[model samples]
Target: MEAVDLTAEQRAIIEADASDLAVSAGAGSGKTRVLVERYVQLLRECSIPQIAAITFTEAAAAEMRDRVRREVMSDPALEQHRALLDEAAIGTVHSLGLRLLREHPVEAGLDPAAAVLADDEAELLRRAACIEAIDAAAEVGGERTRALLGLGVYHAGLQLPRMVAQRDAVGAAFAAMGAYSADWPSYVRATLEAHYEPRQTAIRGQAEEIAWQIRRDAGNVTERLAEVAGAVLQPLTAAREAREWGDFAALLAEARSQTNLQSGGNAPAAVNVKGAMKELRELDDDAGKLPAWNEHDEPALEVLAGLRALFEDSVRRYEAAKQAQNALDYLDLELGAVDLLRDHPAVAAAVRGRFLHLMVDESQDINPVQAELIELIAGGNGDGARPALFLVGDARQSIYRFRGADVHRFPAQQALV
Candidate 1:
């Protein structure tokens, strides 16, 4: 790490000690180089096994490991640490979780010999579990069963497996929706206000300006065009002042439906008045397009609730099948690792004690579950006494949403740190 060639930001990143950091660097801005330099600095005080450097893929992990090795080999003082690189936790988060689970299989409540299932094997198991859950639910014959059937069994059959595959994310969404069940109206109203209120305010100001100009230039403007401007301005004013969305929408509708303002001469005042009216009409047209949020029966929520029940049942069956076969899927690795860390205090303390620094690359793609696992291992809120957690990723490059990646978690974790 030569100071002569490094930028100020890079120097800050490398020199900053102990405090948690979330660095967002764009492509080719030497993000990887900065991360490698930081890792090298950590190696001066921490053993390879004491730090965790997690990325997205095997190739990336290999590249990062190679960079660390090269940096270590370049300096004579780091000779003793070179051999420990192979045992370092530098790989995908899933691989790290797998390592944790294998180390504490008894505490994790899993068979010591359980192997990770192949993609094809996991998909087959998911499909089987979904079918079994659907059949069992249908056999029970209840309101939910009827609701599930009403959504079309064939459609449910096609969609339920996909949903089951991402059960953790879907389950979390369902929980959030249930939490807001009593406040949907407030949520809807707030959303509407945030979006339309500003535009309405701008329109009101613009229309008022146009109205004043028309009045001041009344001697130059025709009487017919003045009447048209008055007609449009009245509703526009009412729409802007209306407190309720319904009243505002109705006013916009009335304004947009007014007779068109036409210019009969080349006079500048007539042309200005006509053009102003036309522009006002277009703006009101946009305002009128606001969606009316009328309360009605939401059958989809009921069907989704029923599907949610089936999804849970499917998950239980999936776990049972995996346990019977003595195998674990990728999801199982993370969930198991989290369970192991959170449920057993001794295991958690040992893990926290083992890793003094945690660094995650491409952290923007981490979902809530993975974030929770990171927190559990990092010893909670990253406050005093917690090991430093380094997160570096650009939110724009988050492309793993299908595997439950939520880009919002990046900023949120940054704020917490």
Candidate 2:
């Protein structure tokens, strides 16, 4: 392509030779133009089939492909490469997976002729699976069944499908690593442990330290101030000795229940007393982070676990039903691609060979599954030389969580690159 009147920043982006590049550009800032120009430059050195350009949507992909074709046509020197633009790998991640599976049907363990299920067909199958799951739960007739029944009654039997609709987001949330990864049970357990155990320990330690300081200063303060300080220590001592987790909240409440301690009038001595009282009250307020458990919380926790089991069973039934129809949904498409790349080394190598460079657009909206597929395709396993990875997205623009987008994954992927 001929050189055009471009800003220095746009020229730099097009000319940069970084192995892994991440562009953070806002809308109408020529992000697409930079990507198209960069792609055209790469095409001069690499075959069109050796590069992969992935976008979040088919329309964006088409626009990029069109721009690349236009650039090729604009250059008389690039006349021979015009026909190759039609064969370039430019599409959404789902389309990329579909192409991969189509190329290696046997390795992907699918019937060569198997088709993706239409939205209406998938919804019908999901409904059938939900009904079957409900009937099976009724036969069992236990806590799990009761939870499912309650949810179904509340949502008029749409609860299962609703949860299924959010399967991708839930799965992405669960798959996050480190402190971010926690299921319902794990979250509850962690919260309780933080509040009742480690948090209690820290609170007691801080209270004892403050109590000692109060005792040391009591003799220098007015009699009223000393009296208030002793009163403050009582609740802290009680909290330190309390064995029941339930009593901690009560102690905090008692500590905060003291009034008028901070309302002393404007005498010098009274002002000093009020200042001390204010500090003690602030400590009590800080201790209130430990939430009080309601009488129904224990029972509700039990019901939540049962409901989680029911949801898992429903998901299994839904997958089975889809498999029986030799069909794949959108989630299945992404997951199947990951599995194909991970399990079949020959196929993975073939894919790696086919695409030497990978450019992803709107990458901030990528979920865990799509991220995994990208990593695998880019040889991110540390087993070999990685491909040239180019990511362009504005994390602030990633708002597709209901469709399984995790904005946080962008930073993690950037770190990987």
CA lDDT of each prediction against the hidden true structure:
0.77, 0.74
TM-score of 1: 0.75
True lDDT of residue 55, candidate 1 = 89
Off by over 4 Å in 1: 1-6, 118-120, 132-158, 172-297, 379-384
Candidate 2 lDDT, tens digit per residue, 288-403? 76665567665665655556556667789988887777778877788889999999987887787677689998889898889999989884565555568888888888867767
- The regions of model 2 sitting more than 4 angstroms off are 1-5, 118-121, 135-140, 156-159, 165-188, 191-295, 382-385
lDDT (tens digit, per residue) of candidate 1 on 1-417: 566778989988987896788899777888888888899888888788889988877889999999898888889989999888789889988899999988997898778777888768999999998889888988997644965777777877787777777787777766655543344445545666787777766756665675566555545767776676667668867765776766766776676566465454668987776666666677667766765555453444456567767777888998899889988888878888889988987788788877889998888989887898888876463433456889898888888887778999888778746
- What local lDDT does model 2 show for residue 120? 76
The candidate scoring highest on lDDT is 1
Q: Name every residue pair that clashes in candidate 2.
A: none
